[model samples]
Every structure is written in C-alpha cells, then in structure tokens.
Target: MAAYPENNRTWQIIHNARKGGYAVGGFCVYNAEGVLAVIKAAERCRSPAMIQFFPWTLHFHGPAFIKYAAEVARAASVPISIHLDHCLKPSDADLALECAFDSIMVDGSMYDEEGNIKYVKSVVDRAKDKGITVEAELGRMEGGEDGLPTIDLESVFTDPDMAADFVKKTGVHFLAPSFGNVHGPYPAGGAEKHWRLDRLEKIHAALGDATPLVLHGTHPLSDEMIRVGMARGMVKVNQNRNVRNGYHEYIAENCTKVELTTLQVEAVEAYSKGVERLMVEVFDSAGKA
Candidate 1:
C-alpha cells in the first residue's frame, strides 16, 4: 500500500475507474442483506466495489456494525471498500472517522461557503491521521434520502469557477458537485430534463482528473444519463434504491410465502443480481477487479 489515499481502498477503486474510463458504484446499503449483496455481486463479477451507508447506519446499527461491515468488505476476493455517506453532523463525522470506513462523505452543505470549507478541512486533516479519504459536497443537493432530512432552503449549485479552489482549500479526496441533481426522485421532467450535464462538464473540466467526481441523486436516472456523467468525470457513482429494486420486489412478493430465513437468503441473492447487472451494464466495472 502507498501513503494516504493511495493506501485507501475507496480511493484506489475510484482512481482505477478513472484510469479505465469507467465509473465505480458506491452501493449505499442499510442492513446485513445490503452489505452481503454488494460483496456477493462484486466477487461474482470480479469488480472493485464500495459499500456505502448513511449516518443512520452508524447510529442505529452502532459502531460494531460498521466494523463488521468493513471487516467483511476488506476480506472480499476483489477490492471492496466501505464508505459512510452524507455525514451531515460534525458528531457523525467524528464517529465515522473512528470507524473502519475506507472513506467518508463529509456533508457540510448546511453551512455557508466559508464554514463548509473550514469544517471539511478540519475533518480532512483529522481523517488523514486515521488513513481515511474524505469526500464532500461542494453545494447543497436538494431533496432527502433515507437518513437525511428535507431542507426548506433553496438549492445551491456548485459553481464551476469555484470548484478547483474548493478542492484545493478543503484537501478533500473526492468532489460531489451539486449540478441540479436531487437526492430522491426527480421533478416532472425526470433526470433528463433536470440534470445539468453542461454544468457538470464544466465542474469536471475545472477539477480535471486530479480530484475524482462522484455522482449522487440517481434514484430514477437513466443508464444513458449515467454514461454521460461517467464520460464527463463521474468516477464514483453513489447508488441507493435503484440497485435494490429487484430485491425489494422479491421480498414484497415472497415475505408471506417463504420462511423468514429463506426470505433473507433469496432476497440477498436477488439484490446481488441487480447489483451485478449494474456492474456489467451501467458502471462497466465488471472484470476490472
């Protein structure tokens, strides 16, 4: 292993994607089934994967659960890293840095530009000591996810002009720029109409390949749009429910018919199948392990 991010699992996975001209999915999971699904899919496809969790997992499941997730992820046959997604609170960041996460997304969007920079920088400095790479949101992503709350504030898009400076000042490893991407479902026109690919391109051009770009708000995104992001600079694609639809369907249909134990087994298998499809289809990470 090398120093800092070079030694980190998520960094190397994302960097490998950038070099290979593809994007790696950071699968956001909530439970044991989700964790198992990511590992199984990555191993089956021989893809480098990252399992992501919201702040809820860290708190609800506790630190022990995070350790368990990280342990299994690290032991995977292929490169599988564990990440904490949308760590909004400073306390959450503190708790996450102490865990076994390979990387963490420091969500400082609640603060102003200066406050966000300082908060992220402080986390980055502390994270270095623990050998964890940091990913932070440059501007506020609208809507809410499983663990996040709804914001009444207006959406703030990341300025391409300030993109490079934000990365330079914060010392963050990955940049998740908010360019008309929402956390949950899209508005009337869907992602095709709402996504600002041109703005995304500008952000990527400003940062270049030095700081890998992360794609968020992919609930109902089309595969074509995903390709557009990867072609631009999205190296790490954070996925939540889109990849688990099959598993959710299976559970909903078979929960009453199948035994509890069998339900979980088949559910995870279904989940892995969906993830494997994305591995080969959208992300194109299959066989890159």
Candidate 2:
C-alpha cells in the first residue's frame, strides 16, 4: 500500500501551493543519491517536494528502487511524493502504479488531439480507480530527454481553447502545456526566446485556476520566469538537468583527489545542495510545507 493515499498528500501539497501562489519542484531522480538528495532537501527546507522518475530511469534501475523512494517519502518530515514522469504508454502508467507512485504523468502529447485525449482519459480512468493523481500533457515539448527526439516549437505550442477542452475532457489533476519551455538544458549562451508568460496567462484564463498547470523544461529558466509562471497558476515545475549538472560537475571536480567511497558521498552532497538551492531560491517552495 502507498504510505500516503494517492491524491491526498500530493494533491494537497500541489493544490495548496497553487492557492498560495508558490510552485513545488518536481526533481527527477535516477539513483539512490538523487532520491536521497531530494528528500533531504525537502526536509531541510521544510518544502513540499516531489521525487520523480522517467520511464527510462525506471527501466534502468527497476521497480524495486521505487520501494526505496516510497520508504524515504514515508519517513520524511516534510511532504514528498514519488511520481512517474512522462510515461508514453498506458502500460508505463500501470507499471508505475504497481510501483506505488502517488502521481503519474500520462504523456500522450505525440498523438493527434483526439488521440491524445483518448489515451490520457484511458490512463486517467485507471489511475482514478487507484485514487492516484494523473497529470497529462496536451502540448508537445521540444528538446529530447531520455533519448526522446526533439520536436519543432511551432508544431507543439499549446492552444488555449484546446487546453481548456482537454482539461475538462480528461479530468487530469494537472496539465503540462507547451508554453515556450523545452526539455534539457538551454545553449551555453542561453535561449534566445524567453518563456512566453503571455501565452501561459492565456491558458490560465481559459482553464481558470481550478486546473493546476505543470511546467516541464525548467532547467534554464530564470528565477523571474519561474515566479511569473507560478503566479500564472503553474503549481509544479520539473527540473532534472540542473541537478544532473551539479552531480557531474562535483564528480569531475573532485574525483581525482578523493577516495571512491568519499567521491560518492561528495556527489550526493553536491547534488543535494543544487536541488536545495532550487527548492529554496528558485521555486520558492522552501518553508511552504
């Protein structure tokens, strides 16, 4: 059984943050260090945080790892939820459910509008039976994460009217719309175009505040952009590359001098600091728990 009932702790955390005009960080974890980092950061900062896994990460690490994540969430002082991020198929969602995820993102955005709605609704129906919260994507996100191919921006930008319809039709707990955000890191110089807050505002207007919005591709966005998105009803922001960057940078910087065991410890510490910085400084979820 899940430690916290599905849609109970996770939903309350997100809904409360949305109502309070703050955003929770959905930090993607691929290993024990990643999971420990997120949980420790949340506990230290007193923030409501989420530890998420991509389908590929789950494939690499296996379902048993999820139990460890669940155990950590159950033992944590602050609110934390384990979520499956960007599941492309219903079977993927089912696998996550089996692993006892509190929330799942059923991403059928590669399909046509009708097909996307149909697929997401099917997953939503199943998740609802388990009392699990479902988050579905309506707009395709550009840039690839976990070996997915990159998509063009023009083809994937979400339509406000369609977003409203999709939310009502699928009954998802949250919606991730493509409003000028992409997965993966921005170029070294930064993205030429800024996050289209105006477009996000339009979607907020169409969907109203009842439907909480989720923003993916959060790695390279500025603090101001994040604050603007949260103010416009974005309740969850997924950040992975930045955390990975921090981990890799730490290893690269310290690997030569440190013992192998100490190196691993340093990596976790660095990654935790990176994630904590986002939780406290960037996302503003610190102390919100």
Best by TM-score: 1
**Best by lDDT, which number?**
1
Identify the runs in model 1 with alpha carbons over 4 angstroms from their true place: none
What is each predicted model's overall lDDT from 0 to 1?
0.92, 0.82
Tell me how many clashing residue pairs each candidate has: 0, 0
Question: Which parts of model 2 have CA positions greater than 4 angstroms off?
Answer: 1-7, 185-194
Model 1 Cα RMSD, 1 decimal: 1.0
TM-score of each: 0.98, 0.91
Per-residue CA lDDT of model 1 for 84-163, tens digit only, reads 99988999999998899989999889899999999999999999999999999998888879878788777788999888
Candidate 1 TM-score, C-alpha based: 0.98
